[model samples]
Target chain A: MSPLHLCLALSAALFCTGLVAVLIRGNAILVLLGVELMLNAANLNFLAFWRFGPGGGEAGLVFVLFSIAVAAAEAAVGMALVIAVHRHLRSIRIADANRLKG
Target chain B: MTTLLAVLALICLAPAVAAVLVRNLIHSALLFVLAWLGLAAFYLALGAEFVAFAQALVYVGGVSMVALFAVLLTRPGRTDLLPPPSAARAVGGLAAVSLVASMLASSLFWSRLPSMEPTAPIPLRRLGELLAGPYLVAVLLVGLILTVALIGGLLLAAPRRPAEGADA
Candidate 1:
């Protein structure tokens, strides 16, 4: 298999695992971790493409940097939301959060 | 070259899958951090220096820490902290498998993409120029948005009226 090919497969696997965790899990923290895993998987894909795809090194590198900064910001916001949820509900379980609509 | 990359790629994926499957939330989060590190290694293998470092700095240093703190804030009594999947979670597992398989197949076959040219050096400086030249506006806007969000979070987390109208 091509080296880039292997990286792509790995990224895909990471993303899929993350997706599974996000979808089936009832814990908010686990869900957040799942999301982070998904984001990293995509970033890996970007880096791989940059390395072996068309973006080449520099442009891909810079773009990935931008993505990382954005991910950081997203993490901050996400954590804030988690704190809010924990405070309001006193439970980190997602199944219990159904009070809003259910 | 292919073998080296393949090995590195496997290394990246192992912990990533473990991150999702582990029982303890804290341990899983730690594994997630390691997974990101592996991805950074993959980036380096691809010759994308900036991407690799950015992954470490932003993902490892920034995002992962935030995730840890957020998770730390949540330590509900052991009454209810559900772990991994049961047989009922089979549907999700199936979907995940299908998704990974499809993506790999499409990228490998349908794209027919030519491997990057090995002779030409990566245009690192050009990216820098573009960042300052054309992408600065977007970057500044994003920063402004983040500032606003941070302020909003602080406001939300501020002390509020207690239930039963107790003034404290």
Candidate 2:
């Protein structure tokens, strides 16, 4: 298989795994990890398209860098929220917290 | 080239699955670190040296640490890391994942994928120029966002001081 095809397949599989993780995991942290995995998979798609797409690939790199920055910020805020939730609920399981169920 | 790609695939995918599978939150976090490192390797394979370095530095050095810290701070006394999901939930997840995977595979196979290899590596100087030029606003915005997020996170995570009389 071509490198592009290989990368596309790899990224697709990873994205699926991440989605499953998100759907199944009860722990908020694990869910966060799943989100991160999904983000990485998307970034991989960008890089692959950039490498294999017509025209130049600089735009893809730029987008990837920006995405990484945004992801770091997201992780920070997400962990903070997780910590705050744990403080209030004393548990980190998603199934246990039902404050928003109403 | 194929060998390198295979190794990179292993590095990224295996630990990712393992991270989700492992019962220990700490182990999961560490395996995630490995997966992030593999992602950096993927960027390298694509010849984006700057991105690869940045990915390694940020995700591995920064985000993973933050996750570990969060895990430690919020740890329950005798809680299970791998909580059991219902059979229905597992089946739903599997179905959703498989559906998405099939769609992706079909799209990839149907498209006329181009194969333009990078003849030369993108220079750091050019990237800086682009970031400072047309993308300057985006660059500034990212910096602004990060700053705000950091301050907000600190405020949220900071220990609340008890009122003097209330505590006593």
Candidate 3:
């Protein structure tokens, strides 16, 4: 397989691992980490296509940069939410965070 | 070259798998940093030097610190072992993930991907121009969003004051 194919396959596998982590893990932080993994997988796909596809320009690179910034923002907000939830519930387990208001 | 890619893939994936499976929250967070570093290496291999550095700085540097801090701040006890998920939940999640993975792999293989030659990496200077020129609006928007998010995060994570003399 070409390097492009290899990159795509790796991205798919990473995405799948992330999905499983999100679905199975009880910890809110791990679930957030899983989301980060999925986002990174998507960024890898973008970089792969940009490297191999026609009309190679700066668009893909720019998009990935924006994506990285957004992902960082998401991580900040999500972690804050996790901390808030933990303060309220005294546990970071997703199952324990059943109530909407405390 | 293919063998190198295979090695890189192993480096990227193993820590991710271990992170998910490991019971300790701190270990899981650190393992994620390893996975991010592997991904940055992949970016370097792909000839996106700027992106690779940004990935290293932003992800491995910034986000991993955030994750580690969150993990530390929210740990319930001395030993941060997460309880094992229910067997049914684990099996079901694995089955669903595998189904999606198979579908993605089959589609990827069956599609006629263009066999294009790898292009020269864009100069960092040109990339900067594009960001300031055509993508200026997007850059501004991202900045705005990031500022808002940071402020929101601070507000959300701040300690609440106890109600004082409310009934008096």
Error of 3 at B43 (Å): 0.3
Clash pairs, candidate 1, are: none
Better of 1 and 3 by DockQ: 3
Of the pair 1 and 2, which is ahead by DockQ? 2
* Reference-based lDDT, each prediction: 0.72, 0.87, 0.90
- lDDT (10s digit) by residue, model 3, range B57-89: 998888999988998898778778888998998
Candidates ranked by lDDT = 3, 2, 1
The pairs that clash in candidate 2 are none
Answer with 2 or 3, whichever has the higher DockQ: 3
Highest TM-score scorer: 3
How many pairs of residues collide in each model?
0, 0, 0
Number of clashing residue pairs, candidate 2: 0
Fill in the DockQ of model 2. Answer: 0.75
lDDT of 2 by residue, A1-102 (tens): 778888888898889878877998778998998998999998998888777666576788799999999999999999998998898888888877788732
Compared with the true structure, what per-residue lDDT tens digits does model 1 show for residues A14-84? 87888777877767877877887788777777666766776435555556666666766667777777787
lDDT of 1 by residue, B125-147 (tens): 86678788878886787788778
Q: Measured by TM-score, how close is model 3 to the native structure?
A: 0.95
